[model samples]
Target: MNAERFEALAEAFGGDVARWPADEREAAAVLMAARADWARSVLGLAGEVDTALYAYAPPQASVGLADRIAAAGPRPGRGRWMGFLWPAGLGAGLAAACAAGIFVGAHLSAAAVSAEPLEPVTMAVSDQDFDFDLDGEV
Candidate 1:
């Protein structure tokens, strides 16, 4: 039943008591009855503001606005996969590398088979070769 609460309700909901919040409307009405003059002054100003807002006219959009917006949008086309092939030049490069590897491998293997066998070197091992002092301790 506060005057400030009554003023706020009247301003927001307009001069109609029914339009005010159901729970608060009764208390606000009591305040309005107790201070009719103040409540009327606040509600009168609120009504004036509401009237001016209602009287305003909104501007219309320009002609062909819908057409322009529609035209600017994306057009339907083939699926995403149709756009481009992935790793475009990698296939050709890979084929060329494989061919070069086969050629080199064949050439190396043929040369190895045709080359002269290395002569086996004969050496004598003795106990003196293993007589050095080891650096690590057990």
Candidate 2:
């Protein structure tokens, strides 16, 4: 690798060439051996950077963070299990229900109409035919 790329890799992966990407490690080693003085300077800077980074202290999380998380409760699965009951699914379900209701209502209406007996198709039928003479007369 060129001096620039070797130096960049050393800076990125720290002073340890072994920790560098395996594909570039051999080339980086050859370049470093060729220019020992440059390699020493670059490695020294990388070591210093690593030391400073390792010494950093991160800020802790706010108080009651665990309690807040615990109180929130476990969330339900929002994966494929609930994919069927979507905006489109709701419409499909409603359409299916309406179709079923129409089928059942049609059957019920037909049954009701057929259940009651039809009146005889008589032209001269009169209420008096079934009435009794209140007086004792013919």
Candidate 3:
């Protein structure tokens, strides 16, 4: 199809070529015809190509395979409780661990502080070598 005609068709059909405006029904019909012709040509070639592809046969199972599969019983699907149980249990465990850690830390700190003795505050000074010279020296 020519570029101008394709552009006109594109505009008439809005952005989606599959949809057409009622006002441009005639133009939409022409575009549809062109598209149908193109699709028919492409589909014919696709059918031939598909026919040329080689067919594949699945491998056959061993004689005892059916018996073994039947013996295994139905496949186990996921349990509903596990979905809620695991997360809830994990969260509870973590909260307990955090609380235990905080309690231990505070207890140890209190014990250490209480065990230590308070030191006495003292001041030392040397006596003056000379006697008091408190006489008035006018």
Candidate 4:
């Protein structure tokens, strides 16, 4: 690797060549051996950053936060077993329901087709069907 690429890798991998990607490690080692002084300077700067990162301590979570998270998690029972079969079982249930609905619909439609047709009735309206007074009296 060239000096620029070696420096980039050192920055990214935090000065530890062992932490670098396997394919890049051998090239980095060759470049480091060829340009020892410059490589050491780059590695030294990167190592300072790595040391600071390693020394960092993140703030602790509030008490019972873990317990609350655990409490909200899925409980052991029917749901756990059902989770394994969820996709397949749900698809099967929907298919069965559709099949049942189709069967019932077909049976009902056939019954309707075989049933007797209703006779038509006729009605006539004439003026004699109602009596009216012009004066607003019942």
List the candidate 3 regions with Cα displacement exceeding 4 Å: 1-34, 74-138
Candidate 1: tens digits of C-alpha lDDT, residues 21-127: 89997787788788888888888887887788879989877999989999755556723432232235657766878999999999998887789775788677755
lDDT tens digits, residue span 44-125, model 3: 4544534454355558999999999996554356256545555578688668889999999999989878998656775555
Candidate 1 lDDT trough over 10 residues, lowest sum: 78-87
- Over all chains combined, what TM-score does candidate 2 have? 0.41
Q: Which candidate is the best by TM-score?
A: 4
CA lDDT of each prediction against the hidden true structure = 0.75, 0.81, 0.59, 0.84
Q: Against the hidden true structure, what lDDT does model 3 obtain?
A: 0.59
Clashing pairs in 3: none
Clash pairs (backbone) in predicted model 1 = none
Q: Which structure is stronger by lDDT: 3 or 4?
A: 4
Better of 1 and 4 by lDDT: 4
Q: Which stretches of candidate 2 lie over 4 Å from their true place?
A: 18-22, 34-37, 70-138
Order of the predicted models by TM-score, top scorer first: 4, 2, 1, 3
For candidate 2, which ten residues in a row score worst on lDDT?
A: 78-87
Rank ordering of all candidates by lDDT, starting from the highest: 4, 2, 1, 3
TM-score of each: 0.38, 0.41, 0.25, 0.50
